[model samples]
Target: MSTQITTDRLVLRPVEASDAARIADLVNDPRVYRMVARIPANQTVAQTLAWIAGHTAGREENTKHPYAIVENGELVGVTSAHRDSTWLPFEIGYWLSPDRWGNGLMTEATEALVGWLKQRGERGFVSGYLDDNPASGRVLEKLAFMKADRIKVFCLGRGEMVGHVNMARID
Candidate 1:
Protein backbone atom coordinates (compact mmCIF):
# COMPACT_ATOMS: atom_id res chain seq x y z
CA MET A 1 0.00 0.00 0.00
CA SER A 2 1.12 3.59 -0.57
CA THR A 3 2.49 5.48 2.38
CA GLN A 4 0.57 8.32 3.97
CA ILE A 5 2.33 11.14 5.80
CA THR A 6 0.86 13.68 8.17
CA THR A 7 2.10 17.07 9.27
CA ASP A 8 0.93 19.46 11.96
CA ARG A 9 -1.61 21.04 9.62
CA LEU A 10 -1.66 18.82 6.59
CA VAL A 11 -1.89 15.22 5.48
CA LEU A 12 0.21 14.02 2.59
CA ARG A 13 -1.59 10.99 1.21
CA PRO A 14 -1.05 8.90 -1.84
CA VAL A 15 -3.12 10.23 -4.70
CA GLU A 16 -6.27 8.18 -5.06
CA ALA A 17 -8.32 7.20 -8.12
CA SER A 18 -11.33 8.85 -6.49
CA ASP A 19 -9.55 12.20 -6.55
CA ALA A 20 -9.67 12.57 -10.33
CA ALA A 21 -12.53 15.06 -10.43
CA ARG A 22 -11.07 17.28 -7.73
CA ILE A 23 -7.65 17.06 -9.30
CA ALA A 24 -9.11 18.04 -12.62
CA ASP A 25 -10.90 20.96 -11.05
CA LEU A 26 -7.72 22.19 -9.39
CA VAL A 27 -5.42 21.83 -12.36
CA ASN A 28 -7.91 23.19 -14.81
CA ASP A 29 -7.56 26.57 -13.19
CA PRO A 30 -5.17 28.61 -15.34
CA ARG A 31 -3.55 29.95 -12.19
CA VAL A 32 -2.47 26.42 -11.30
CA TYR A 33 -1.91 24.98 -14.79
CA ARG A 34 0.19 27.83 -16.18
CA MET A 35 2.72 27.45 -13.41
CA VAL A 36 3.15 23.68 -13.63
CA ALA A 37 5.24 22.44 -16.54
CA ARG A 38 3.39 19.26 -17.49
CA ILE A 39 -0.29 19.85 -16.78
CA PRO A 40 -2.32 20.96 -19.70
CA ALA A 41 -4.72 23.84 -19.21
CA ASN A 42 -8.37 22.93 -18.86
CA GLN A 43 -7.67 19.27 -18.28
CA THR A 44 -10.64 16.93 -18.16
CA VAL A 45 -11.53 14.50 -15.39
CA ALA A 46 -10.61 11.61 -17.70
CA GLN A 47 -7.18 13.07 -18.30
CA THR A 48 -6.57 13.54 -14.59
CA LEU A 49 -7.63 9.95 -13.91
CA ALA A 50 -5.27 8.72 -16.60
CA TRP A 51 -2.47 10.62 -14.91
CA ILE A 52 -3.35 9.32 -11.44
CA ALA A 53 -3.38 5.75 -12.81
CA GLY A 54 0.40 5.82 -13.14
CA HIS A 55 1.14 6.65 -9.51
CA THR A 56 1.02 3.07 -8.28
CA ALA A 57 3.39 1.75 -10.90
CA GLY A 58 5.65 4.72 -10.37
CA ARG A 59 5.73 4.11 -6.64
CA GLU A 60 6.56 0.42 -7.12
CA GLU A 61 9.36 1.21 -9.54
CA ASN A 62 10.67 4.13 -7.47
CA THR A 63 10.71 6.34 -10.52
CA LYS A 64 8.13 8.77 -9.19
CA HIS A 65 6.33 9.56 -6.00
CA PRO A 66 3.25 11.77 -6.04
CA TYR A 67 1.29 12.88 -3.01
CA ALA A 68 -2.00 14.60 -2.58
CA ILE A 69 -2.03 17.56 -0.19
CA VAL A 70 -4.96 17.45 2.17
CA GLU A 71 -6.03 20.12 4.63
CA ASN A 72 -8.98 19.59 6.94
CA GLY A 73 -9.97 16.52 4.94
CA GLU A 74 -10.04 18.43 1.66
CA LEU A 75 -7.65 17.69 -1.15
CA VAL A 76 -5.87 20.92 -2.06
CA GLY A 77 -2.81 20.20 -4.17
CA VAL A 78 -0.28 17.72 -5.50
CA THR A 79 3.46 17.38 -5.09
CA SER A 80 5.81 14.89 -6.65
CA ALA A 81 9.38 13.86 -7.34
CA HIS A 82 10.62 12.01 -10.37
CA ARG A 83 13.75 11.37 -12.38
CA ASP A 84 14.05 10.31 -15.99
CA SER A 85 17.31 8.43 -15.38
CA THR A 86 18.57 6.67 -12.31
CA TRP A 87 21.74 8.73 -12.34
CA LEU A 88 19.80 11.96 -12.25
CA PRO A 89 18.58 13.61 -9.09
CA PHE A 90 14.86 13.50 -8.49
CA GLU A 91 13.13 16.69 -9.61
CA ILE A 92 10.40 17.84 -7.32
CA GLY A 93 7.37 19.71 -8.55
CA TYR A 94 4.02 20.86 -7.22
CA TRP A 95 0.81 22.77 -7.96
CA LEU A 96 -1.66 23.98 -5.38
CA SER A 97 -5.12 25.38 -5.62
CA PRO A 98 -4.91 29.14 -6.11
CA ASP A 99 -6.90 29.65 -2.96
CA ARG A 100 -4.08 28.13 -0.99
CA TRP A 101 -1.27 30.29 -2.30
CA GLY A 102 0.66 32.72 -0.04
CA ASN A 103 -0.03 30.58 3.02
CA GLY A 104 3.30 28.74 3.05
CA LEU A 105 1.47 25.45 2.54
CA MET A 106 3.54 24.42 -0.46
CA THR A 107 6.71 25.06 1.43
CA GLU A 108 5.51 22.96 4.32
CA ALA A 109 4.28 20.12 2.14
CA THR A 110 7.43 20.06 0.02
CA GLU A 111 9.72 20.14 3.04
CA ALA A 112 7.94 17.09 4.42
CA LEU A 113 8.20 15.31 1.10
CA VAL A 114 11.91 16.02 0.91
CA GLY A 115 12.37 14.79 4.42
CA TRP A 116 10.58 11.58 3.53
CA LEU A 117 12.86 11.07 0.54
CA LYS A 118 15.92 11.69 2.66
CA GLN A 119 14.71 9.10 5.11
CA ARG A 120 14.64 6.66 2.21
CA GLY A 121 18.36 7.46 1.55
CA GLU A 122 17.80 9.75 -1.40
CA ARG A 123 19.74 12.98 -1.17
CA GLY A 124 20.13 15.09 -4.25
CA PHE A 125 17.14 16.92 -5.64
CA VAL A 126 16.44 19.50 -8.31
CA SER A 127 13.43 21.70 -8.92
CA GLY A 128 12.49 24.55 -11.17
CA TYR A 129 9.86 27.23 -11.35
CA LEU A 130 8.66 29.45 -14.09
CA ASP A 131 10.66 32.66 -13.93
CA ASP A 132 7.42 34.55 -13.65
CA ASN A 133 6.30 32.68 -10.57
CA PRO A 134 8.19 34.13 -7.66
CA ALA A 135 6.00 32.42 -5.08
CA SER A 136 7.21 29.01 -6.19
CA GLY A 137 10.81 30.13 -6.16
CA ARG A 138 10.28 31.35 -2.62
CA VAL A 139 8.98 27.94 -1.58
CA LEU A 140 12.13 26.29 -2.88
CA GLU A 141 14.32 28.93 -1.31
CA LYS A 142 12.71 28.45 2.07
CA LEU A 143 13.65 24.77 1.83
CA ALA A 144 17.35 25.60 1.21
CA PHE A 145 17.28 25.01 -2.52
CA MET A 146 19.88 27.25 -4.05
CA LYS A 147 19.56 28.89 -7.40
CA ALA A 148 21.44 26.73 -9.88
CA ASP A 149 20.82 28.37 -13.24
CA ARG A 150 18.24 29.47 -15.70
CA ILE A 151 16.96 27.52 -18.67
CA LYS A 152 14.15 27.53 -21.15
CA VAL A 153 11.52 24.88 -20.69
CA PHE A 154 8.47 23.90 -22.62
CA CYS A 155 5.27 24.59 -20.72
CA LEU A 156 2.31 22.64 -21.98
CA GLY A 157 -0.19 25.16 -20.71
CA ARG A 158 1.53 28.13 -22.32
CA GLY A 159 2.16 26.33 -25.62
CA GLU A 160 5.66 27.75 -25.73
CA MET A 161 9.05 27.64 -24.15
CA VAL A 162 9.42 29.91 -21.13
CA GLY A 163 12.15 31.08 -18.83
CA HIS A 164 12.72 28.71 -15.94
CA VAL A 165 14.87 29.08 -12.86
CA ASN A 166 16.46 25.84 -11.79
CA MET A 167 17.27 25.15 -8.15
CA ALA A 168 19.00 22.28 -6.41
CA ARG A 169 19.52 20.94 -2.91
CA ILE A 170 21.90 18.31 -1.59
CA ASP A 171 20.67 17.02 1.73
Candidate 2:
Protein backbone atom coordinates (compact mmCIF):
# COMPACT_ATOMS: atom_id res chain seq x y z
CA MET A 1 0.00 0.00 0.00
CA SER A 2 1.12 3.57 -0.62
CA THR A 3 1.98 5.56 2.47
CA GLN A 4 2.77 9.18 3.20
CA ILE A 5 6.37 10.06 4.03
CA THR A 6 7.76 13.31 5.38
CA THR A 7 11.29 14.63 5.14
CA ASP A 8 12.92 17.73 6.53
CA ARG A 9 11.51 19.92 3.78
CA LEU A 10 9.07 17.84 1.83
CA VAL A 11 6.04 15.61 2.08
CA LEU A 12 5.79 12.57 -0.15
CA ARG A 13 2.20 11.50 -0.45
CA PRO A 14 -0.02 9.73 -2.92
CA VAL A 15 -1.34 11.75 -5.84
CA GLU A 16 -4.85 13.11 -5.48
CA ALA A 17 -7.38 14.59 -7.87
CA SER A 18 -6.97 18.03 -6.31
CA ASP A 19 -3.34 18.03 -7.40
CA ALA A 20 -4.20 18.19 -11.09
CA ALA A 21 -3.58 21.91 -11.60
CA ARG A 22 -0.23 22.04 -9.84
CA ILE A 23 0.94 18.82 -11.48
CA ALA A 24 0.01 20.17 -14.88
CA ASP A 25 1.91 23.37 -14.22
CA LEU A 26 5.07 21.56 -13.20
CA VAL A 27 5.03 19.00 -15.99
CA ASN A 28 3.95 21.40 -18.70
CA ASP A 29 7.31 23.05 -18.32
CA PRO A 30 9.50 21.96 -21.20
CA ARG A 31 12.44 21.58 -18.88
CA VAL A 32 10.62 19.05 -16.74
CA TYR A 33 8.99 17.20 -19.62
CA ARG A 34 12.29 16.86 -21.45
CA MET A 35 13.67 14.68 -18.68
CA VAL A 36 10.60 12.46 -18.25
CA ALA A 37 10.10 9.68 -20.76
CA ARG A 38 6.36 9.09 -20.59
CA ILE A 39 4.87 12.48 -19.87
CA PRO A 40 4.01 14.54 -22.90
CA ALA A 41 4.65 18.24 -23.15
CA ASN A 42 1.92 20.86 -22.86
CA GLN A 43 -0.47 18.80 -20.74
CA THR A 44 -3.73 20.51 -19.88
CA VAL A 45 -5.50 20.41 -16.51
CA ALA A 46 -8.08 17.97 -17.80
CA GLN A 47 -5.37 15.69 -19.01
CA THR A 48 -3.54 15.94 -15.72
CA LEU A 49 -6.68 15.15 -13.79
CA ALA A 50 -7.21 12.07 -15.86
CA TRP A 51 -3.65 11.00 -15.23
CA ILE A 52 -4.03 11.49 -11.50
CA ALA A 53 -7.18 9.42 -11.51
CA GLY A 54 -5.34 6.65 -13.26
CA HIS A 55 -2.46 6.96 -10.82
CA THR A 56 -4.83 6.69 -7.90
CA ALA A 57 -6.39 3.64 -9.46
CA GLY A 58 -2.99 2.12 -10.01
CA ARG A 59 -2.16 2.53 -6.36
CA GLU A 60 -5.41 0.86 -5.34
CA GLU A 61 -4.65 -2.00 -7.67
CA ASN A 62 -1.16 -2.40 -6.20
CA THR A 63 0.37 -1.56 -9.53
CA LYS A 64 2.24 1.62 -8.59
CA HIS A 65 2.96 4.20 -5.95
CA PRO A 66 2.95 7.71 -7.44
CA TYR A 67 3.42 10.54 -4.99
CA ALA A 68 3.03 14.26 -5.04
CA ILE A 69 6.07 16.13 -3.84
CA VAL A 70 4.79 18.85 -1.59
CA GLU A 71 6.94 21.65 -0.21
CA ASN A 72 5.39 24.18 2.10
CA GLY A 73 2.06 22.56 1.32
CA GLU A 74 2.36 23.17 -2.42
CA LEU A 75 2.90 20.55 -5.06
CA VAL A 76 6.26 21.05 -6.76
CA GLY A 77 7.00 17.70 -8.32
CA VAL A 78 6.30 13.95 -8.32
CA THR A 79 8.02 10.68 -7.43
CA SER A 80 7.02 7.08 -7.91
CA ALA A 81 7.92 3.41 -7.42
CA HIS A 82 6.40 0.94 -9.80
CA ARG A 83 6.88 -2.27 -11.68
CA ASP A 84 8.56 -2.22 -15.06
CA SER A 85 7.24 -4.69 -17.56
CA THR A 86 10.57 -4.94 -19.35
CA TRP A 87 12.53 -5.30 -16.10
CA LEU A 88 11.64 -7.34 -13.06
CA PRO A 89 12.90 -5.01 -10.37
CA PHE A 90 10.82 -2.26 -8.84
CA GLU A 91 11.52 1.01 -10.63
CA ILE A 92 11.75 4.37 -8.94
CA GLY A 93 11.40 7.63 -10.84
CA TYR A 94 11.03 11.31 -10.06
CA TRP A 95 10.97 14.81 -11.53
CA LEU A 96 10.87 18.29 -10.07
CA SER A 97 10.03 21.76 -11.20
CA PRO A 98 12.93 23.38 -13.01
CA ASP A 99 12.87 26.29 -10.61
CA ARG A 100 13.60 23.89 -7.77
CA TRP A 101 16.66 22.37 -9.35
CA GLY A 102 20.15 22.68 -7.76
CA ASN A 103 18.61 22.72 -4.28
CA GLY A 104 19.19 19.08 -3.30
CA LEU A 105 15.47 18.59 -2.74
CA MET A 106 15.38 15.68 -5.16
CA THR A 107 18.26 14.04 -3.38
CA GLU A 108 16.61 14.47 -0.03
CA ALA A 109 13.28 13.23 -1.32
CA THR A 110 14.87 10.23 -2.99
CA GLU A 111 16.81 9.27 0.11
CA ALA A 112 13.67 9.42 2.19
CA LEU A 113 11.82 7.19 -0.22
CA VAL A 114 14.66 4.70 -0.33
CA GLY A 115 14.82 4.67 3.41
CA TRP A 116 11.12 4.01 3.59
CA LEU A 117 11.43 1.12 1.20
CA LYS A 118 14.37 -0.32 3.09
CA GLN A 119 12.43 -0.17 6.31
CA ARG A 120 9.73 -2.17 4.62
CA GLY A 121 12.27 -4.89 3.75
CA GLU A 122 12.61 -3.92 0.13
CA ARG A 123 15.97 -4.11 -1.58
CA GLY A 124 17.44 -4.20 -5.05
CA PHE A 125 15.29 -1.39 -6.36
CA VAL A 126 16.04 -0.33 -9.93
CA SER A 127 16.07 2.98 -11.75
CA GLY A 128 17.45 4.66 -14.84
CA TYR A 129 18.62 8.08 -15.94
CA LEU A 130 18.98 9.61 -19.34
CA ASP A 131 22.58 9.75 -20.53
CA ASP A 132 22.40 13.50 -20.87
CA ASN A 133 21.04 14.07 -17.35
CA PRO A 134 24.18 13.42 -15.34
CA ALA A 135 22.67 15.22 -12.40
CA SER A 136 20.18 12.39 -12.06
CA GLY A 137 23.03 9.90 -12.12
CA ARG A 138 24.59 11.71 -9.20
CA VAL A 139 21.38 11.37 -7.28
CA LEU A 140 21.41 7.60 -7.83
CA GLU A 141 25.03 7.50 -6.77
CA LYS A 142 24.11 9.33 -3.60
CA LEU A 143 21.72 6.46 -2.92
CA ALA A 144 24.52 3.98 -3.64
CA PHE A 145 22.89 2.47 -6.71
CA MET A 146 25.48 0.79 -8.90
CA LYS A 147 25.38 1.03 -12.66
CA ALA A 148 24.09 -2.23 -14.06
CA ASP A 149 23.89 -1.55 -17.80
CA ARG A 150 23.31 1.01 -20.48
CA ILE A 151 20.65 0.80 -23.15
CA LYS A 152 18.79 2.94 -25.64
CA VAL A 153 15.17 3.67 -24.83
CA PHE A 154 12.57 5.74 -26.58
CA CYS A 155 11.47 8.83 -24.67
CA LEU A 156 7.84 9.51 -25.36
CA GLY A 157 8.08 13.11 -24.29
CA ARG A 158 11.13 13.84 -26.39
CA GLY A 159 9.73 11.72 -29.21
CA GLU A 160 13.16 10.16 -29.86
CA MET A 161 15.39 7.43 -28.63
CA VAL A 162 17.93 8.32 -25.94
CA GLY A 163 20.63 6.50 -24.07
CA HIS A 164 19.76 5.34 -20.55
CA VAL A 165 21.90 4.17 -17.67
CA ASN A 166 20.26 1.43 -15.66
CA MET A 167 21.11 1.33 -11.96
CA ALA A 168 20.35 -0.94 -9.02
CA ARG A 169 20.88 -1.02 -5.27
CA ILE A 170 20.85 -4.60 -4.00
CA ASP A 171 21.49 -3.93 -0.35
Candidate 3:
Protein backbone atom coordinates (compact mmCIF):
# COMPACT_ATOMS: atom_id res chain seq x y z
CA MET A 1 0.00 0.00 0.00
CA SER A 2 1.04 3.55 -0.60
CA THR A 3 2.41 5.48 2.37
CA GLN A 4 0.78 8.69 1.26
CA ILE A 5 -2.91 9.51 1.69
CA THR A 6 -4.89 12.60 0.86
CA THR A 7 -8.31 13.89 1.85
CA ASP A 8 -10.30 16.94 0.92
CA ARG A 9 -8.17 19.36 2.93
CA LEU A 10 -5.10 17.45 4.04
CA VAL A 11 -2.27 15.18 3.06
CA LEU A 12 -1.43 12.28 5.30
CA ARG A 13 2.05 10.98 4.65
CA PRO A 14 4.61 8.91 6.46
CA VAL A 15 6.28 10.78 9.29
CA GLU A 16 9.73 11.91 8.27
CA ALA A 17 12.93 12.50 10.18
CA SER A 18 12.86 16.06 8.94
CA ASP A 19 9.61 16.65 10.78
CA ALA A 20 11.23 16.19 14.18
CA ALA A 21 11.48 19.87 15.03
CA ARG A 22 7.93 20.70 14.03
CA ILE A 23 6.56 17.57 15.63
CA ALA A 24 8.39 18.35 18.82
CA ASP A 25 7.07 21.86 18.88
CA LEU A 26 3.48 20.75 18.41
CA VAL A 27 3.45 17.86 20.86
CA ASN A 28 5.33 19.75 23.50
CA ASP A 29 2.71 22.43 23.59
CA PRO A 30 0.89 22.17 26.92
CA ARG A 31 -2.48 22.03 25.25
CA VAL A 32 -1.47 19.18 22.99
CA TYR A 33 0.49 17.31 25.64
CA ARG A 34 -2.35 17.31 28.15
CA MET A 35 -4.58 15.41 25.76
CA VAL A 36 -2.02 12.94 24.41
CA ALA A 37 -0.81 9.95 26.38
CA ARG A 38 2.80 9.28 25.50
CA ILE A 39 4.62 12.49 24.70
CA PRO A 40 6.54 14.23 27.43
CA ALA A 41 6.05 17.82 28.35
CA ASN A 42 8.82 20.02 26.94
CA GLN A 43 9.99 17.25 24.65
CA THR A 44 13.22 17.90 22.80
CA VAL A 45 13.92 17.64 19.10
CA ALA A 46 16.28 14.70 19.68
CA GLN A 47 13.53 12.81 21.48
CA THR A 48 11.18 13.54 18.63
CA LEU A 49 13.71 12.19 16.16
CA ALA A 50 14.02 8.99 18.14
CA TRP A 51 10.26 8.64 18.05
CA ILE A 52 10.32 9.13 14.29
CA ALA A 53 12.95 6.42 13.96
CA GLY A 54 10.69 4.02 15.78
CA HIS A 55 7.98 4.77 13.27
CA THR A 56 10.48 4.08 10.52
CA ALA A 57 11.21 0.69 12.04
CA GLY A 58 7.53 0.09 12.46
CA ARG A 59 6.99 0.70 8.77
CA GLU A 60 9.68 -1.85 7.90
CA GLU A 61 8.10 -4.39 10.26
CA ASN A 62 4.58 -3.73 9.05
CA THR A 63 3.50 -3.23 12.64
CA LYS A 64 2.90 0.50 12.75
CA HIS A 65 1.86 3.23 10.40
CA PRO A 66 2.46 6.77 11.58
CA TYR A 67 1.48 9.71 9.48
CA ALA A 68 2.38 13.37 9.42
CA ILE A 69 -0.75 15.39 8.97
CA VAL A 70 -0.25 18.17 6.45
CA GLU A 71 -2.64 20.97 5.64
CA ASN A 72 -1.80 23.81 3.28
CA GLY A 73 1.68 22.33 3.03
CA GLU A 74 2.46 22.56 6.75
CA LEU A 75 2.78 19.75 9.22
CA VAL A 76 -0.09 20.18 11.64
CA GLY A 77 -0.34 16.95 13.59
CA VAL A 78 0.43 13.26 13.88
CA THR A 79 -1.70 10.11 13.67
CA SER A 80 -0.78 6.49 13.83
CA ALA A 81 -1.90 2.86 14.21
CA HIS A 82 0.10 0.33 16.14
CA ARG A 83 -0.32 -2.88 18.12
CA ASP A 84 1.61 -4.35 21.00
CA SER A 85 0.85 -7.93 20.00
CA THR A 86 -0.32 -9.66 16.89
CA TRP A 87 -3.61 -10.75 18.39
CA LEU A 88 -4.54 -7.34 19.63
CA PRO A 89 -6.27 -4.86 17.41
CA PHE A 90 -4.15 -2.03 16.07
CA GLU A 91 -4.68 1.07 18.17
CA ILE A 92 -5.20 4.45 16.58
CA GLY A 93 -3.84 7.58 18.20
CA TYR A 94 -3.51 11.22 17.23
CA TRP A 95 -2.84 14.73 18.50
CA LEU A 96 -3.12 18.02 16.69
CA SER A 97 -1.98 21.59 17.23
CA PRO A 98 -4.43 23.21 19.61
CA ASP A 99 -4.93 26.10 17.24
CA ARG A 100 -6.45 23.61 14.80
CA TRP A 101 -9.04 22.21 17.18
CA GLY A 102 -12.78 22.11 16.42
CA ASN A 103 -12.13 22.31 12.71
CA GLY A 104 -12.99 18.67 11.86
CA LEU A 105 -9.44 18.14 10.54
CA MET A 106 -8.89 15.35 13.03
CA THR A 107 -12.02 13.52 11.99
CA GLU A 108 -11.07 13.91 8.36
CA ALA A 109 -7.54 12.74 8.95
CA THR A 110 -8.56 9.81 11.19
CA GLU A 111 -11.29 8.68 8.88
CA ALA A 112 -8.79 8.64 6.03
CA LEU A 113 -6.32 6.66 8.12
CA VAL A 114 -8.96 4.11 9.12
CA GLY A 115 -10.10 3.77 5.56
CA TRP A 116 -6.53 3.26 4.45
CA LEU A 117 -6.09 0.54 7.04
CA LYS A 118 -9.33 -1.15 6.04
CA GLN A 119 -8.10 -1.26 2.48
CA ARG A 120 -4.97 -2.99 3.74
CA GLY A 121 -7.01 -5.69 5.55
CA GLU A 122 -7.05 -4.27 9.05
CA ARG A 123 -10.33 -5.44 10.55
CA GLY A 124 -10.34 -4.19 14.08
CA PHE A 125 -9.14 -0.95 15.59
CA VAL A 126 -9.00 0.30 19.17
CA SER A 127 -8.60 3.83 20.47
CA GLY A 128 -9.02 5.69 23.71
CA TYR A 129 -9.29 9.18 25.09
CA LEU A 130 -8.89 10.64 28.52
CA ASP A 131 -12.27 11.11 30.22
CA ASP A 132 -11.76 14.85 30.38
CA ASN A 133 -11.34 15.12 26.61
CA PRO A 134 -14.84 14.85 25.22
CA ALA A 135 -13.82 16.24 21.85
CA SER A 136 -11.72 13.18 21.24
CA GLY A 137 -14.67 10.99 22.07
CA ARG A 138 -16.71 12.86 19.52
CA VAL A 139 -14.08 12.24 16.88
CA LEU A 140 -14.12 8.49 17.54
CA GLU A 141 -17.88 8.42 17.64
CA LYS A 142 -18.01 10.10 14.28
CA LEU A 143 -15.97 7.19 12.97
CA ALA A 144 -18.37 4.66 14.49
CA PHE A 145 -16.06 3.60 17.27
CA MET A 146 -18.13 2.23 20.14
CA LYS A 147 -17.20 2.63 23.76
CA ALA A 148 -15.62 -0.62 24.93
CA ASP A 149 -14.25 -0.04 28.39
CA ARG A 150 -13.29 2.44 31.03
CA ILE A 151 -9.81 2.18 32.44
CA LYS A 152 -6.98 4.25 33.84
CA VAL A 153 -3.90 4.69 31.74
CA PHE A 154 -0.79 6.62 32.46
CA CYS A 155 -0.49 9.94 30.76
CA LEU A 156 3.18 10.73 30.63
CA GLY A 157 2.51 14.38 29.98
CA ARG A 158 0.07 14.55 32.83
CA GLY A 159 2.55 12.68 35.05
CA GLU A 160 -0.16 10.43 36.46
CA MET A 161 -2.77 7.87 35.62
CA VAL A 162 -5.92 9.34 34.16
CA GLY A 163 -9.37 7.95 33.50
CA HIS A 164 -9.48 6.55 30.00
CA VAL A 165 -12.33 5.39 27.83
CA ASN A 166 -11.44 2.75 25.29
CA MET A 167 -13.34 2.53 22.08
CA ALA A 168 -13.28 -0.01 19.28
CA ARG A 169 -14.26 -0.29 15.66
CA ILE A 170 -14.79 -3.80 14.38
CA ASP A 171 -15.53 -4.77 10.85
Task: Report the number of the highest-lDDT candidate.
Answer: 3
Q: What tens digits encode model 2's per-residue C-alpha lDDT throughout 1-171?
A: 789999999999988888888888888888888887778878899998887777676676555778888899888888887774423456889999988899999999888887887786667688989999999999999989999999998887788999999999888
Highest-scoring model, TM-score:
3
TM-score, every prediction: 0.96, 0.91, 0.97
Off by over 4 Å in 2: 84-87
Estimate candidate 2's alpha-carbon lDDT, on a 0 to 1 scale. 0.85
Worst 10 residues of 2 by lDDT: 81-90
The Cα local distance difference test for each model comes to 0.90, 0.85, 0.92
For candidate 2, the per-residue lDDT at 78 reads 88
When superposed on Cα atoms, how far off is each prediction in RMSD?
Answer: 1.1, 2.1, 1.1
**How many Å off is the CA of 82 in candidate 2?**
0.6
* Tens-digit lDDT track of model 3 for 11-115: 999998999999998888888999888888999999998888877877876678899999999999988999866577889999999999999999999999999
Ranked candidates, highest TM-score first: 3, 1, 2
- 70-138, model 1: which lDDT tens digit per residue? 999999999888887667788999999999988989999999999998888888999989999998999
Query: How many pairs in model 1 have backbone atoms within 3 A of each other, for residues 3 or more apart or on separate chains, i.e. clashes?
Result: 0
